[model samples]
Target: MDYIDRAEATRRILAAKERAGLSFEELAQVVGAHEVWVASALLGQNTMSSEQAAAAGKALALDEATVAALSRDAARGSLPAAVPTDPLIYRFHEIVQVYGTTLKAVIEEKFGSGIMSAIDFSMDIDRVDDPRGDRVKVTLNGKFLPYRTW
Candidate 1:
């Protein structure tokens, strides 16, 4: 599908999800995948398998085109700007900006010169209760890929 088509399909999927009163976690159960991955697939960041697409489509009451779009290869990271303007999204960008070098240094100290693999990554988000306030816990797990010697 074209960019506009994909955007519209995403809107339909989100609307149908809201209309059905289903959480991404619930939809993940129906699609038999992780909630984050399912959410990413639905938002056009990742491609879903035909079976997953069908399951999600059935659960969300999505049309054929939207379902098909879900299974298509996505042009990921379709952000409008390099720095996200949305507050929540911007927080993540801010975090990376602040901690990018520190993380790299620390990780290299432990794992040697290498980078984390986004292709082989998994993430989990949780709510942690605290006396002061609830805390958001985000876990990012990725394989460590060491730089190869030429």
Candidate 2:
């Protein structure tokens, strides 16, 4: 509850899971946590809030006392020591951060009023086997709908 070293708390919480004989993936599945988060928490690379720690504790079948201890541990933490090395998918995000305004203006200019329907959207990924190396292909499909008239 007091000033907890974020890094230290992460270690203790993760140790709790490990002592339960659960692998990172297994513990994540049990606690409904993302495997990445579980891994980070254990490695003292990621911090959590009281709520998150409590939830994780409950998921790991930790006792009430342990849950309380973790809840206190959750706060007073920062991000993972190392940033994830993987590249972020930027195309989809462009719709939110970059082209969002421009696209809105363009759509308003072309159509009376409309939006792309996520409900009708679809995605497909192809895993191709190659003698040189594997290849991943991705495709997206979606329907566009105009806003209702007055």
Candidate 3:
């Protein structure tokens, strides 16, 4: 098996959609992505983001876990993992991921500087009570330094 087989995830997604009696355009429309994006991912020419995969799961009537598995496989080049030898740079990397664009947007809008200093950042997670349900509250603070110009 190729260590990174892009085709497998794409192929599986396409196959799953087909087996479920849906068309490419239909799936793409349901998932709120362009048809071209769906086609490219199905052809193994593109990668699907978690947001996209989650939406796709709803469109395809698939469990979130299966969609997540496909995304994970696609990231790894489609080979089966054995014990996940890769070290986690972020302690929560195995469970939580950095949503790059979302974080970047918030950072740019708030601090108007460069990224959060991973070295100088702090994270706090706590449970909060809500009328609807319990919610996990997280707060992050980091020193801000403007980007240096050459």
Candidate 4:
């Protein structure tokens, strides 16, 4: 059998999901993972566990090979350029460009000379209704790792 290409498989999976009108939240429920994580895995940024992959495959009506491919490590960081061209994604980049230093300084002052652990992070996105307009609330929770002096 030919080897499964994860990128291609992810593309196929996304197409099938679209055709089936399955939202990331729906698929995440099937796989028992957060919607953002499920979307990231589908977009080839993260690898899913075998059980999660199988659950996703069943929900998306994907083939066995594609399910197995989902369990493999993704190359990740598949951005076309250093600066993304997409408008929504670019706004995030702009936010970091403007507030990154301020955030770093604040974080350092609060947590000492160390960094937050992305590997041990959790994120939540929520929608809050308002009179003027709805608001998007994003929360990033990461482990505070202190620098060790040898």
State the C-alpha lDDT per candidate: 0.91, 0.60, 0.62, 0.89
Q: Pairing residues by index, what is the TM-score of model 4?
A: 0.93
In terms of lDDT, the poorest run of 10 residues in model 3 is: 73-82
Residues 60-135 of candidate 1 have per-residue lDDT tens digits of: 9987889998988876776876789999999999998999999999999999999999889999999999999999
lDDT of 1 at 138: 98
Where does model 2 exceed 4 Å of error?
47-51, 59-150
| Candidate RMSDs in order | 1.9, 9.0, 16.7, 1.4
| Most lDDT-accurate candidate | 1
Question: lDDT tens digits, residues 1-150, model 2?
Answer: 344454555556667666777777776675566665656554544445567666677666655554544434334233344543445544445445677799778867877588876556555656899999997775655677898878
Quick one: best TM-score, which candidate? 1
**Which one wins by TM-score: 1 or 4?**
1
Candidates 2 and 4 compared: the better one by lDDT is 4
Which pairs of residues have clashing backbones in candidate 4? none
Which of 3 and 4 is the better model by TM-score? 4
The per-residue C-alpha lDDT of model 2 at residue 20 equals: 75
Sort the predicted structures by lDDT, highest score first: 1, 4, 3, 2
- The residue-by-residue lDDT of candidate 4 on 1-150, one tens digit each, is 345898888789989999899999999999999998888898888899999999998888988888888988877776776899899889888999999999899999999999998778788889999999999998989999999999
TM-score of each model, paired residue for residue? 0.94, 0.36, 0.38, 0.93
